[model samples]
Target chain A: MIVDSLPRTTLTEIAGMAGGGAALPALAARLNIVEMTQAAEDAVLQPKDAGRWPHALRAALAARIARQNDCPALADRYAGMAGADMAVADPAVAGEAEGLTLVCRFMDKVSVSPRDVAARDILELQEAGVSDADIVRLCELNAFVSYQVRVIAGLRLMAESVA
Target chain B: MNDVIHKFTRNVPDWRPRVTPVKLEDATPEQLDALQVTPSNTKVSAYVLTLAHDVETLKVRSPLFNGIMYDPGGLDRAARELSALAASVLSRCVYCAAVHAARHAQLSKSTEVTDDLFANGDKADLTPRDRAIFDLAYGLAGSPPAATPDQMRAARDAGLSDAEIVDAILSSALFGWANRLMHVLGDPVRKGAA
Candidate 1:
């Protein structure tokens, strides 16, 4: 697929893979993966059935994860999509006012120190009245952003190598 | 009840979800479709059923996962498994590490690499090639992604093609997605054994 037509949120665009930026010939072999990645971003960030988490909140969380990964460009993009939840895009802003203090803590731990997450973490969420399904929804959002941030970072490193 | 496995091991352990999995009988049409619950294939793992709560992401992720890992002709299967293991180990996702480590051993037809990995971790003794691949994947798996141009050069110097390097990135990044789900949503345990 042509790079121009690719979604702006895609790694191809976010990592500057187009226009002589990391456009390795091998990338063509995985066009399907690229496209599916955009589709995944949509599914996670703006799904038709967003469950308890609104699209804006998901976008804020996505930005927060991107920032934690130090991908400012990607974080900026997600922050733009956050709308009213934009404050939460800043990792420093605890989501307490938004009634998301536990959610934010859970997301931060899962994103930065996943190894330390334990059964008690899930128990805390459940105790706070977060449903089982909402917990799953939060995880999918956090997990997808983690994947996206790494891919963009990897692509940028690839670009730098070729440059 | 079962004891959660704290340390990494090559033997794949049972995954126990901290949250309740969606009951098969109560699944909606969309959840059922995403789960691919055919009459012939009714047995879904708790991990997958738990994911069915967000069927939209689950649907797209399943295919993207298979395409990255199982699609032919980029990085070799064993090498892809190695990348996956690198990410899982860094994330400390015991379930993911075990499954991918076993696959790496099976595909490479040797346990030496995984055994060393489980023993020495990031300091695992490896060939120049495996070291380059593991280092790249491990760096990429970090929160701030520490992989540098030098590491990319090392991979090329180790004789990895651009295609292989891309595959390494994808396989490792894919686990960045998988590890959070498996490690956060559940525990790896010895089923039926305390």
Candidate 2:
């Protein structure tokens, strides 16, 4: 349904995905648009289930750490725990989780300039004592010279660790 | 480390597709600069200038033309959705990943979905249709050559229409060029800025 409504660019993109129309357009065009639209509209109107798998993913991650301890079974069992809703009680955990969610959510949007280096590299460089100012300077100079941001960031990290 | 290599992969070339880095900075004064390459008899600076023009076109056309095209008008959302589309492209873009990731979250109106996006681009909490959109974008952005017939079958099974599918390809291609420029020229002005 949503597919029916999207413009040609998006459609072409989707078509391109199926391996460029000469191959897949016949099948894609044959899809039942009317039925699909109804299903999507209904889905959007329904209420959401908040306490879902996000925390479960984290728990599973946490469980891996906990497994080294004596209570492996208990740790593993707890790892499967579902993520609680933000509206539910525990303010502190909720607050931190919310913040983390925002960071992650923010990541979903913009296409970062691949020219810049990884942030992890910058963070590491900072740890090694290369000032933030120098890192910023490098980024600017590299921009002018058309240097890769990833390399620049990596160098900063290396410089910091060495410094 | 090979920062330049890190920024551009075989799928995407540097700003001047034909020009090498050494050629860009070291060519004689009479020789054309990297930014100067363009089709003859045109004032445009080839790749970079073309992008600047198209981005403006996308902005205006998205509102006027694409507005009427989609029933509810998804172009703004589409632009906003470009963030999500971008996240999938920026794996090589250390500078771009977080920015697009953040925009993806804002469009979805949920932190949870956004986080899921970074953890997994196509597998994020998008609707089936949108997922189809993401998958299409991913295939185009990642490996245009290998994006074979079977890949389109997957999208069809996922429920993208012929038209929507076409749009998805255009969006991905637009990003293909857009991502390269941003990667090369430096947009978002900051690593984390969405």
Candidate 3:
């Protein structure tokens, strides 16, 4: 499980800042935010009710997003949770074998070019028979992964600066 | 027909969800808890209702969002708003941009910064500090997160303390999360049009 790999220290494992005590002080002041961030990661990646997307699929998507953002360590951590759905973690796979080509395309667009997304994108999903609830679930997963990627990137920069 | 707003504005736009929102009457106990709906606070926006479909994330996301954007100290409110606005602009999340821009203008007590931003985008003329903050946020909001050590140094040189810089990262990164849901799940249309 993704939660199993989480470090006890706030923002340390996710941001790959272990042994760097410099950024700890700044992070300690906002410990609530840090803790809540972990809670959010759990909620999105492995929610009690995962809706249409299972935990393994969510982890694959999370790993894919992390790679898209060039965060290999974070990607590797999530990849461990991907189980049998690991091929979906590669951006070049296109998800055809998994019957998720459309889903993959939608996620790629939303992740890299959200501004270009429009009503038609949702329409296509609807036409493909994806439920409204499932659509929301997919988006929450994609959105949370996007947020996590940037936070990891930012935290690394913070650690580097203070180091 | 109500027009979908394509340009950046301080006038907040209404968000119309493409998916069916969870009806309040049909909401499960868990969804109600996530929505935080009390009798006195029964009113909820369409956006919130749409998000109620994924109650787990909604539950934790709300508190984390508030802590990053509204917690005392760290980055000043206006600076945090600026970081949010920068991310919104980069993602072209019109609804998020307008709302944060308005908040930024209100907090700063002037439209000068948002006005310049709306008119010129990344080339908007800003005070050195605002420039550094905006640039850092814009870079961090990119798909691969283009923020570099130089931008971090620029923010420091612009007088932002470490705490303030961390706040900027959180606010901007929070919007990176927000923009996908807002821009991808719905359309930003004129008020009452949907």
Ranking by TM-score: 1, 3, 2
Q: Each candidate: what lDDT? A: 0.91, 0.35, 0.89
The Cα error of candidate 3 at residue A83, in Å, is 0.9
Candidate 1 stretches with Cα past 4 Å from truth are A1-9
Q: Pick by lDDT: which candidate is best?
A: 1
Please list all clashing residue pairs in model 1, or write none if there are none.
none
Error of 1 at B40 (Å): 1.1
DockQ-best of 2 and 3: 3
- Please provide TM-scores, in order, for all candidate models, with all chains considered together: 0.96, 0.34, 0.96
- Please write out the lDDT profile of model 1 over residues B1-194, one tens digit for every residue: 33899899989989999999999999999999999999999999889999999999999999999999999998999999999999999999999999999999999999999999999999999999999999999999997789988999999899998889989999999999999999999999995541
DockQ of each: 0.80, 0.03, 0.74
- Cα RMSD for candidates in order: 1.8, 21.5, 3.4
Better of 1 and 2 by TM-score: 1
On a 0 to 1 DockQ scale, where is model 1? 0.80
Model 1 docking tier (incorrect/acceptable/medium/high): medium
> Which 10-residue window in model 3 chain B sums to the lowest lDDT?
B1-10
